[model samples]
Target: MSAPMPPPTTLEHARWERFKSKLGGWSLTTYGILAFAFLYLPIVILVIFSFNDSRSVSKWSGFTWAWYGKMFQDGQIMLSIWNSLFLAIVSTIIATVLGTLAALGLERYRFRGKTAVDSMFYLPVIIPDIAMAIMLLIFFNMSGIGFTPWKVNFFGARLAVPYSVIIGHVAFNTSFVAIVVRARLAQMDRTLEEAASDLYANAWQTFRRVTLPMLMPGIIGGALLAFTLSLDDFVITFFTSGAGFNTLPVRVFGMIKKGVTPKINAVSTLMLVVSLSLVVVSILISMRSGSEDSVTIGM
Candidate 1:
């Protein structure tokens, strides 16, 4: 067979190319709009419906703040909120300390099986929540820690918190915090630490004065992320909370099973506000610290 020649330059070919280019642009624009609308339109609706006067979340009723007032006045809701706050704060603190240490160790040092250890740190982050919850439940049961509440006295108010739930939250949150802090560490300038060392500063002094201050933004971001995750977690919380134990997320789930109401919407809206506030604070910290690259919460 004879070799075939390429298509000749023609007016029709030029017009086809122009048509394809316009189609590409329009398609991309349409998809972009759809993607944003898909993600955020529901959130806007949720916020708007939270003000509905009627109990029906799906129906548009006259605006009223009664639901919000009722939400605050509900003792169970207030207790759940308090429990959620305490759990998140405690878990975040523990996760931040451990995660920062892990990041520092993994980033600043190298050793045998270092790669293996690094991979292990990511398991909790990548694992399914249900699987982790089951494992934690089993482990607690086998270890004789099953559903035992830690009798904690906080500000003169005695609280019985599930140790397993806190442990589970810390377990997963540590990995998230480690990942974020590691990203920050990867971007940090090591020269500051070197200079401090050259100035005859000891290890602790160097870290306290130079390293920690620079790492503060990343640490704060990681802590906030941990707090947000702990606060919003329902699966693990519900599974490990045992009978009569309720955090805000678990309580929300129970209410959802009963049915949706304007009070539920109000409570959900409050939670949304809190989660969004934490995210905003993390971003702001990164921005102010000139380390916007460190807020890798998606990791």
Candidate 2:
């Protein structure tokens, strides 16, 4: 054939392959850096500005603790914080218990219309927050569920908190808890439970000793998620909370309507700290339990 077709140059081919590999790696590294910067830069800025002495959020004044002091002394802010904490604690506890039982029932038992029940449980998690908020508002108003705040005297300060807000939080929080617990249950090794049963253990005993321990990690994760969601909730709480009752998020919204300030920044930063701490704890628990995927289920 024409000069017997020159043999392919191995050196050139190797060089070209190496070039392509290097280019691909560089591209991936750049993308990762850019994505991280985009996500964290704003949070960093917020945290930094929270310490600014100036009232204006955009301007960076010399560092000062005045805002933190103001945040602590502000009665409205402090009261809202307490209300948020109370609502989160109550809703998380209720949601976790109900969600755990539901998960167990669905995973362990086969019943008619199980698919439909499961879908109904998932609706809150899938629906938009605004739509759910409006629906809850309409339902509460039509059903005549009292939005009246229960007035209580706490350490000399008069406080009023609405029970309807807690109910609304529980409604959505239950779905998240169920999803997380269900994911954990689905991934669990059934052999352990079977072994317990084979050893002549009763249903309650087997569940108490084995099932509960295994499920604890997921339960904790779900509870933390529920607490975070309840603490951060705005729309549902806003719609369900009657006049004069405000959680931290609702309080923040009202403040925003007035205008943004360093005081607001301080409140936001504190909230961010709490939320981040809860998320970190949940992640750690999931990692320790060898069920990293459980953390993402609620999300």
Candidate 3:
């Protein structure tokens, strides 16, 4: 038999492989650095300015904690912070429950116009925030409901505006939570449910004991996403919020527009720290969960 001919590695193939490897390596490093800078540069500046004694945003005076102390003393800021927290918590709860149920339904059941339904749920996410805000404004205006501008009842009782803002936040957030939970559901193993059913477990029992546990990570993740989005929301809240209803973001925007101050920087820095810490904690929890899952599988 003749000597086996070596398989040909064409010049084109070699060039393509070299290009891919080089491009992948360079792109990862370049993009990683860019992403870090994009996210953290503003945060770094904010933190630096927070310690500055000067009220001017650009000029740095001696370091001082006066602005932070002032922030604590400002009752409006404190009230806005509390309001934002309450809105986020309530909106996240509502969004998570509805979104998780929607995900489960979409993943486990077949129905008419399934693709259309998915697209509808995702439409809110893709719609421009300004447009959505405008639409919500129009809808609320046309609803024939009495728009009470503001009235201070006993104990400073407020009405309507804050709740409307929460409704808008929840409406947008539900779509996001649905998408995240749906993605998680798509990747889950149907065999587990099938096995549970084979073992004579009813549908509810299987879902409660087996499906729910597996879906918890995605549900929690979606809830966190909803909470963050609600906290960070500005446009919808601004449009829907009537007098006496100011969210943290809207308040900060107004403050910045009037004049930049170290107090604003301090608040921004605090928000950045909280957001980053939440992200890190979420990632750590996810990794720990994944590791535990792998160990269980191995066992």
Clashes of each: 0, 0, 0
Ranking the candidates on lDDT from highest down gives 1, 2, 3
Residue pairs with backbone overlap in model 2? none
Question: Where is model 3 more than 4 Å wrong at Cα?
Answer: 1-35, 144-161, 291-299
Question: Please, what are the lDDT tens digits per residue for candidate 2 over residues 209-256?
Answer: 999999888888888889989999999999888678888999999999
Residue lDDT tens for model 1, 1-299: 46435337777677767887899999999999999999998888888888998888888979999999999999889888888888998999999999999999999998999999999999999899999999898898888888898777766546788999999999999999998888888988999999999999999999999999888888888888899999999999888877898898888889999998888888989999998888788888877987657665755
Say which prediction, candidate 2 or candidate 3, comes out ahead on TM-score: 2
> What's the TM for model 2?
0.92
Per-residue alpha-carbon lDDT of candidate 3 for residues 85-171, written as tens digits (9 for 90 to 100): 777887899988988888888777899999998888888999999999988887777775423333323235342245567678889
In model 1, the worst 10-residue window by lDDT is 1-10
Best by lDDT: 1
Q: Largest TM-score belongs to which candidate?
A: 2
**Global fold similarity of model 3 (TM-score):** 0.82
Name model 2 segments beyond 4 Å from true.
1-8, 151-158
Q: What is the lDDT, from 0 to 100, of the residue 59 in candidate 3?
A: 86
TM-score between model 1 and native: 0.90
